[model samples]
Target chain A: MSQRVPVHVEVNGRGYDREVEPRRTLADFLREDLGLKGTHVACEHGFCGNCNVLLDGAAIRSCLMFAVQAGGRSVETVESLAGSDGELDELQLAFTEHHALQCGFCTPAMLLTAKQFLRENPGVTDARRIREAINGVICRCTGYQQIVAAIAAVAQAQQTAHSIRIETAPPVRVAQDTR
Target chain B: MLAGGQSLVQLLKFRRCRPSALVDINGIPGLDAIERRDGELHVGALVRQQALLDDPQVAESWPLLREAAGFVGYPETRRRGTLAGSLAFAAPWAELTAAAVALDAQLDICSAAGQRSLAAREFFRGPGETALGDGELIVAVRFPAPAPGTGAAFHEVSVRHRDYAQVAAAAQVSPDGHGELVLLCVAPTPHRVDVSEALTRDDAIADLLGRLDPLDDVEASASYRQRVAPVLARRALRDAAERAHRRAPA
Candidate 1:
C-alpha cells in the first residue's frame, strides 16, 4: 500500500488541506475530496481534455497531474466561472444563448479551455484560432459549429466593450491655455 | 521521476509504470531556462512544451522545434508537458524526438556518479527505451544553432488535427542544397536519411523510401506509411530549401 501525502492547494479561491493518496489525480482530488464535480473525467487520460483546469492561470489536464504535484498551487475549475449568486458569466451565457452544448459532458472543460484562450488572446474573433484553442477537449455533440459561434460572439462583444471604454475616457486638460 | 507528469502520470494510472516513489522536479529552480550560451540553445528539463513554443527566440532561431511542437498532444497537454519528459518517455511517434534527432541536440545527463552529454541520435534505443541508466536524470537538452542561411520544416499527416502522426518528416537545409531528413513513426527510433541530393532527381525518392521499415500498427498499415513517407519528405525538403533560400544573403 502507498502512503497518503498532504496537499495544500487553493481551489476556486478557497484553501484546502487534505491527505490524499499519492496516485490520486488532481481531477479526482477536486471531484471527490473537495466535491467540485464541475471538472469531469472522461478518458482518465490526457487525450480527452474533459478534465482540464487552470493551474497557475494556465490550462492543464487535471487527470495528467498528481494531486501532490498541485501542492501550494492555485487551481481554478468550472465552479469558479459562476458567481456566488449562481449568475452565469459571459462565456456561459454565450454558450447557453448559442446552444453550444447538447449532452454537456464536455461543457466544463470547454468553458475552462475557452476561458484560458480568451484570457491569453483577448479580443480574438478568429474562428480558426478559437477552434484550435479548444481542440484538445473532445465534444461528441453540437458538431463544434455552435461552440465556435458562441466563443466568437463573446470575443466580439468583449472587443466592442474594450473600444467603448477607450473611446469614452475623459480628455486631459492643460494648465496653460493656447488659443 | 517527474518533471511534468503529463505522460508519467498517465502511465501510472494505466499501470504501465509502477515506481516505488516519484520525485517531483517541477519545483526545482533554474531547470526551466530556455537560453543560448556557448553557441547552443539550452532547454532545461523543467521547461514546459508550451514555454518552448512561446519563446520568441525558439520561433526566430530554431523554427523547426516550433513547428514540431505545434503538433504535440494539444494546448492543454503542451502547457504541462516537458520536452525532456517526452524524450525520456521515448514514444516512437513523439514529434520532439524527431526534432531533436534532426537538429542533432545533446542531452545533459546527471547522476550520483557524475555528469555526461549524449547525442540525441544515440539517446533512443527503441520505443519507450533509452540509454539512460538507473539514477540518471536528463537535466537539459542543448541544440546547436544551424548554419546561417539554413532553414527547417516539419510535416506530418495525422488522423485528426494534433493527433499522433502516422508518418512525419522533419528536415533542415542549407543554402548549398545540403540537408538532413528524419522520419518518425516509421521505425523503432527516428530514422535519419541522407538528403544531400535533391529529392526531385530520379531515383532519389526511391532510394530514400527503400531505407524505411514501417510496421503495421492499429493506427495505420505498413503499406500506408510507405506510401505517405516520401510525399512528406519531399514537401518538408522543398519547404526547408525555400526557407533557406529566402534567408540566404544577397
Candidate 2:
C-alpha cells in the first residue's frame, strides 16, 4: 500500500488538516470529506466543468487533480462566492436575469468560471467575444445566448463607469502631498 | 492529472484509454512559458490552449498559430488542455500535431534519461503512437523565427468547432524561399509535402496534387480528403504570401 500523506489546505478561507491516500482526487475530498456538495461531479472525467473550482485564484478542474497535488493550496468553490449576508453577486443576478440555466446542474461551475473570466477581463465591450470565450461550456438547455448577454451587460456597465471616471474625475492640485 | 484532460478524460469515459494511475502535471512548476530566445519561440508543455489564444506575443508574432489554437475544443477545454499532452498522444485525428508539423516546430522532451529534441515530422510515428520513449515527458516545443516575409495559416473542418477534426490542414510560405504545406488528421502522422520543386512552378497547386495520397476513413473519404488538401493548401499559401507582402518594404 502506498503511504498516506498528510495535507493541509484552505478552502473558502478555512484551513484543515487531513491524512489521505495519495491517489484520492481533490474532488472526492471536497465532496465526500468536506461535505461541500456545491462542487458537483458530472463527468468524473475532465470534459464537464461541474467539478471546477478556483485553485490559487485560477480556475481548474478538481476531478483531474489529486488531493496530494493540491496540498497546501487555496481552493474556492461556488459556495464561497456569496457574501456572509447571503447576497447574490452581480454575476448571479445576471444569470438569473437572463435565464442562463434550466436544469441548474451546470450553474455552479458556470458562475464560478464567469466570475474568474470577468475579473481578468474587467471591462470588455464586445458581446461576440464574450460568447466565444464561454463557448466550451456545454448547456444542454441551449440557454447560452442569454448568459453571454448578461456577462456582456455587466462588463459594458463597468466600462462605461470607468470611462466616465476618466473623463470627469478632478485632477489633484499642484500642492498634492507625497508621503 | 493527465495535464489538461480536455480530450483524455473524454477518451477514458469512452473506454479508449484506461490508466489505473493519472499523474497530474498541471501543478508542475515552470511548464507554461511562451518565451522567444535567439531565433526560436519556446512554448512550455503545460501551457493552456486558452493562454495561447490570447497571448500578445503569439498574436503579434504568429497570428495563424493563435487562430489555430482558438479553434480547438471550446473555452472550458482550452482552459485546461495542455499543448504537450495533446501532441504526445498524437491520435490519428489531432489538429495540434498537424499544425505543429506544418509549422516545422521542434519538440523538446524530457525523460528519466535526460532531454532530447525531435522535429515534429519525426516525433509522430503512427496513430495513437509517438517516438516518446518510456518514462519520458515533453517539456516544451520550439518554433523557428519567421523570416523577413513569411506567413502561415491553419484550417480544418469538423462537425462542430469542438468536435474531432474531420479534415485539417496547415501551410507556411516564405517569399523567394522554400515553402512547407501539410495535411492533418488524414493519417497516423501529419502528412508533409516537400513543395520545393512544385512551388517553383506557375501552377503549384496542380503539381502539389500529384504528390498527395490521402487516407480513407468514415468521417471523410480518402478521395475527398485528397481533393480538399490542394484547395486548403492553395488558400493557406495565398494567405501566407499576402501577409508577407503586407509586411514587406514598399
Candidate 3:
C-alpha cells in the first residue's frame, strides 16, 4: 500500500493541496507541512484542549483528527483569529489587554474556543455562562479569572457596539420623484 | 469506520485501533439528524454530544440525556463526540451508556449484510466492548417518547469538570411511579438497578451501591466508589422524583 495519501483542503480561506500519511494527524499537518505553527499542541491527547481548531466552523481537537479526515474540509486555526493585515481580533485584543495568558501555551486554543463561543452566543451576556462556554480551553497560568474577564469584556463591547449601531441610525430620506 | 475521532484517533495514535484502513463516515448524508419520529427522538450516528444538550426539543423531551450530556467530556470533546460513537466504543465511564440504560433506548445497526436492532442494555457487554459484529456499524439510537410526569436527574463526581467521573449516577422516573437508576464507572459496564419505590425511599437508592464492587483506577479507589455511589444515587433519585411529581398530572 502507498504510504502517503493525497489530500486537498482549505485553511483560513486559502486553498491548498498536499499529500499526507493516512495516520498523520491534522495538528502535525498544520504545524509541520503548512508551517502554521500558531496552533500549538501540548498533551497530544485530546484532554489538554491545546491543538484545537475550527473544522467547517466548529471547534474540534486537531490532535485527535487525521489530516486525511480533514480532506476537502475548511479549517480555521488560531492563526485565523487574527485579522488579514495581522491585527488581532477583538478576543485576541481582550486577552492581551487583560493579560489572560502567562505562559502562552494554551492561548491559541483559548482564542479559537473563545472566538467560536462569542460568535455562537453573541446575545449571551452572562459572565458565568461565558466562563462555562470557554471551560474546555484550559489555562494553567491565568487562573481563569482574568481569562473569563477578557471574554466578558469582549462580549460587553459587542453588545455596546450593537446598541450604538441601532441607536445611531440615519434618518430615512424617502425616495422622491426627480422630474 | 470513524464517526467521532475523539476516541478512535486517540486509540490510533496510541497504536490501539490500527485498522488497515479507516472508513470515514462523516460524509454519510442525514446521519447528523436529531429528529422526533413517531413520538420517539431518533439520534443519528453523527449527532454530536453537544447538540443533544443544546437542542431545546431534546432538552425538553429527554432531560435525562440532556443532564447527562453535561457530565460527558469537555465542551470541545462533546463538540466532536457522538452518542452513537460513545455507545459503539462501549466505554463504561461514558455518560451515554447510563442515559441509554435509564431511557430504555434501542440501537439500530447495519452492515453490508443486513440490519438489526438491539436493546441498549444488551448492546454493552463491558468496557470497550459491545455486541457489534465485524463489518457492522451503529446507524442510530431510538429514545422512547417522553411520558407525562416523567423526570430525570444525573449526578457525577469527578476530579475536574471535564474529566470522566470516577462514579456517575442517572435516575429516571416513569409516569407510572417506577424509577430506573443506573450507575456508571464502577463496574465493567453500567447496569440498571430496580429500585422499589425509588422516588420516595432512601433504602432503594442506597441499595444501588450494593449491586457491584467498584473497580479501582487511577482516578479513584474502590472504597471511595462504594461510599460516594449512594450519595450520587440519592441526589439523582430525589431530584428526579420531585420533578416528576411537579410534572405529574392530576
Candidate 4:
C-alpha cells in the first residue's frame, strides 16, 4: 500500500497542484511531475548543488527536500530568472557577458544560487565575500573566476543604482505632512 | 516529518532509507522558532541553520554554533538544514553535533505520550544513531548560553572548506580554566572530554586523543585523524581560553 501526499506550490509565478508520493523529492517533482527541466539533478546527494532552487527567496538544495515539504510554499527554479518576454535578468546578462558557463550543466544552479546571493547581500563587493556566497554552487567549467565576476558585476551595478537613486531624487520641501 | 531534507531526501532517492510515511512537519507552527527563554537558548526542530547563523545573539553569545553552521554544507544546503535534524542524525563529523556536545545542550522531545528531554552527551549512541525512541520527535534543542567569562570555538580539518570534516573539535572555556572539549568525526559519536584538570598538564594532553580510536575511511586515513585531532584540540583550547580572557575584563 502507498500514500499520496497533496501539495500546492507556486512555481515561477505559476501555481501548480498535484498529488505526489511522500518519497518524491522536490527536484524530482520539479523535473518529472511539473516538467520544469531547468532544475538539473546531479550527484543526487547534497554534496553537488546541481539541483539548487529558491525556497521562499532562499537558495536550497532541491534534491535534499521532499515535495510534500514544499506544500503551501513558493518555489523558484532556474526557469524563473528569465522574463516572459525572453529577456535576461541583470545577473543572467552578466553571466553571458562574462562567459560564466562552458558545458552549462551547472548553469541553472549557478544562476539561482547567484541570484539568491545577490538578493540577500545587496551591497557586497568584496571578492572574498562573493566567493564565499557562491562556494556551495560548484561549476567545473569556468573555474569560478567568471562566475564570481558575473555575480559581482550585478552587485556593483545595484550599488551604483542605489547611490544614484538617492543622489538624483528631488528634495522634499514639505518635511512634515500629517494626514 | 520533513525536518530538513538535506540528508533524508538523498537517502530516499538512493533507496537507502525507506520509511513508510513522511509527516511533513512544515505545516506545524512554532517549530521553527529560535528564541531565548528561561535562561536557555531554544532552537526548534525546524529552525534552519541560516537562522542561527544570522542571529546576533547566537553570534555573540554562542559563536561556536555559528562557526559550525558555516562548515556544515554549501550555502544552499544551510538555508534548509536544521539543527535538531543534524543532532538526531548524529553523524560523527557533523559540526552541530560537536557544538551540541560541547555546550551540553538539552534536547526536548514529544510523542503521543507527551514530552521529555535528553542531554546532548547522552543522546548520541553511535554513528547515525540517537536515543530518540519510536513515536518520539525532537521538538527543540535547548542550549545553556555560555556564562560570563565563557568563550567557545569550533575547528575542523577537511580537504575542502565545505566537505565533511575529517576531524572536528570544539572547546568551551569558562573562568578558572574549567572547560569542556569535544571532538567529532574521530570516534563513533561526538566525544565530550572534560578538560578542566587536563588543562593543567598541557604537554600530556596528546595522549588523551588515543581514547577515540579514530576510524579509517575514504575521507582520510585513520592516521590522519589521530594526528590531527589533538592538534585541532590544542588550537581550539588556546583560542577558547583567549576568548574567555577577553570576556573577563580587568
Candidate achieving the largest lDDT: 1
Cα lDDT tens digits, model 4, B1-250, are: 5677787776777888888876767769999889888888999999998888899878878877887787888778877888988888777888999899888899999999999999998999998988999889999999998876787778888898778889988987886788889998778888787676667777656877665678789898888898898899988888888888988767
* Ranking of all predicted structures according to DockQ, beginning with the best and ending with the worst: 1, 4, 3, 2
Instruction: Give all TM-scores, in the order shown.
Output: 0.96, 0.85, 0.94, 0.94
Evaluate residue A51 in candidate 1 and report its C-alpha lDDT on the 0 to 100 scale: 94
The candidate with the higher DockQ, 2 or 3, is: 3
Chain A alone, model 1, TM-score?
0.95
Docking class of 4: medium
Clashing pairs in 4: none
Q: Candidate 4 recovers what fraction of true contacts?
A: 0.93
Q: Kindly list the per-residue Cα lDDT of model 3 for residues B95-148, writing each as its tens digit.
A: 989999888899999999999999998988888989999999999999997686
Docking class of 1: high
Candidate 3, which segments miss by more than 4 Å at Cα? A171-179
Q: Per-model i-RMS in Å?
A: 0.8, 2.9, 1.3, 1.2
Displacement of the residue B191 alpha carbon in candidate 2, Å? 1.0
Question: What is candidate 3's CA lDDT for residue A148?
Answer: 84
Best by DockQ: 1
Q: List the lowest-lDDT window of 10 residues for candidate 3 chain B.
A: B204-213
Off by over 4 Å in 1: A173-179, B199-203
Report the C-alpha lDDT of model 1 over A6-118, residue by residue, as the tens digit. 89999989999999998788999999999999999999989989999999998899998889889999999999999999999999999999999999999999999999889
